[model samples]
Target: MSSIFESIEHAQAQLKELAPNQWNAFQQFNELVFKEGALSVKEKEIIAVAVTHITQCSRSTDFHTKAAKKAGASLKELVEAAFVATAIKAGGGVTHGTHVHNAKKTDASDFLYARSNLQNLKSIGKNAHEGFKGYTQFNAAATTEGMLNTKLKEIIAVAVGIATQCPYCIDVHTKKAENLGATNEELAEAIMVSSVVAAGSSFTHIAKMIQSYND
Candidate 1:
């Protein structure tokens, strides 16, 4: 058996040979997304690093971390971004705990995601107050102003929430980010960064696919 963790570069040449036009288009789009816009290149790379964690794309994490550093992001900023990802990802489950209370044999529409569902968390708080309290405290600490401001952290959270596909997180964090004065352009950029990184995560796995085919 061979290691599944093969280098993406090895497969890139193959991909280009197989689909030169699509590969070139992807390259251009990726470059454009990482280039300066509403967010700095540093900010976009940091967002990439943060999102790679939730996507669990080790290769993307390594690549984006280097890109972020090259773009002048400090180690502290990267770590802070990562923590924001952590908090947002974990928060999805915690917030979704509300569904447990309303579970039943019904249509999906019956359980539509309303922000009001978050109020059901009070029950979890009453039943598992200590654990719930602890998690909330950690979430607060992770997202609070530190090396990164609340706004940037919220933006990073939005990106992670998108990658994680956590509608609850998206709703909460986007509003929080807006309250912190994150512009629409900044939010759009964050959404696109998440979108591209998620796509890149799958793209880099072509190395594994190539290996499997050979095996």
Candidate 2:
């Protein structure tokens, strides 16, 4: 397998080139965030680690497992993240299981009585047209050209999935990105960016809680 990192020195080197003022600002931000936010960077890293586990992103699980440790996250935090992810996945499994259980009592012809419904679903193999008749349109104003492409968009989706702890989105985006030929390295970087963004969002929650507490 590829190294968890190409090398640690490389990651530190990239960190060095950031604008000093910006880096300082964000570091100060994350410091307060670590203490007062709904989640610490440690917690965010823990969640990201669990997401990688369930999504089966081998490189990501490996990298974030170490990152969680380096961030001072505890085993409890990691376990919590896993529980949340599993809950979401198990909920989905229950829904699918119900359909399978009903299959025994329901005839296929009756279950899908409408020919059109069956055709549309069965045609998924040959046609995505009906399957994606109104797929979510990207915001033209928010995302620019390079970001809107398939590979890059999948990268962004994976980032969002990790940061948001959304298992289904994680599964979709990981598969899509791989199908589009995204390298393991690029996906890892995208996820790192997402982790920082998620950490920042925790600060928003902290502010809200502080405001409420003060009031």
Candidate 3:
């Protein structure tokens, strides 16, 4: 079997012949999205790293990990960006426990109503509540004033929460980001970055599918 790295290379090679216009469009979009704007290139790359992890795209993770380094993000910064993804993703799961407590069936409405019941965990389930507290502490340490400041980290967290479809996480981090002095514009741009990266990830993988069909 070909390795993932080999497969990525194969996909790139095949795209030029199979879908040149798509390949060019993807390249242009990648360049434009990461260009400096309201957010710095480094910040965008950090968001890319976090979103790639949320999407579980190894190829994207590898690409953005390198891109982030080139943009002057330290190894510590990269890892912290990844931890933002970890915390928000885990928070998504942890927050869902509220639904079980309310005996509420899962749906969009559950996410809206179940979130308010999270505090009930403290009274109803001490151990799980304690674990959640520890997780919160970990999240605080991971995102607060590190190589990346709390504001940027929170923005990345918000974007990850959105990409992961975690409403609770999104609400929590959006407020946190606002508290950290992130403007609405910054928050919106970060979300757009996530949207572009998510779409790009799918576009890149079409080449993989093409290769599979040809094989």
Best by TM-score: 1
Instruction: Judge candidate 3 against the unseen true structure and give its global Cα lDDT, from 0 to 1.
Output: 0.82
Residue clash pairs of candidate 2: none
- Residue 28's lDDT within candidate 2 is 74
lDDT of 1 by residue, 1-215 (tens): 12334445666677788888988888888998888999999999999999999989888888899999999999999999999998888899898888887784255337468878888899989999999998999999999999889999999999999998989999999999999999999999999999999989888887557656755
The regions of model 1 sitting more than 4 angstroms off are: 1-6, 104-109
The TM-score of candidate 3 is: 0.85
Better of 1 and 3 by lDDT: 1
- Write the residue-wise lDDT of candidate 3 on 46-75 in tens digits: 899999998887778888899889999899
- What's the true lDDT of residue 157 in model 2? 52
lDDT score, candidate 2:
0.50
What TM-score goes with each of the models? 0.93, 0.37, 0.85
For all predictions, the C-alpha RMSD in Å is: 2.5, 17.3, 3.1
Number of colliding residue pairs in each model: 0, 0, 0
Q: List ranges where model 2 is wrong by over 4 Å.
A: 1-132, 136-147
Of 1 and 2, the candidate ahead on TM-score is 1
Candidate 3 wrong stretches, greater than 4 Å: 1-6, 104-127
Tens-place lDDT digits, model 2, residues 8-92:
3244344445345655677675444334233345645654665564555554566677877888866655555554445444333
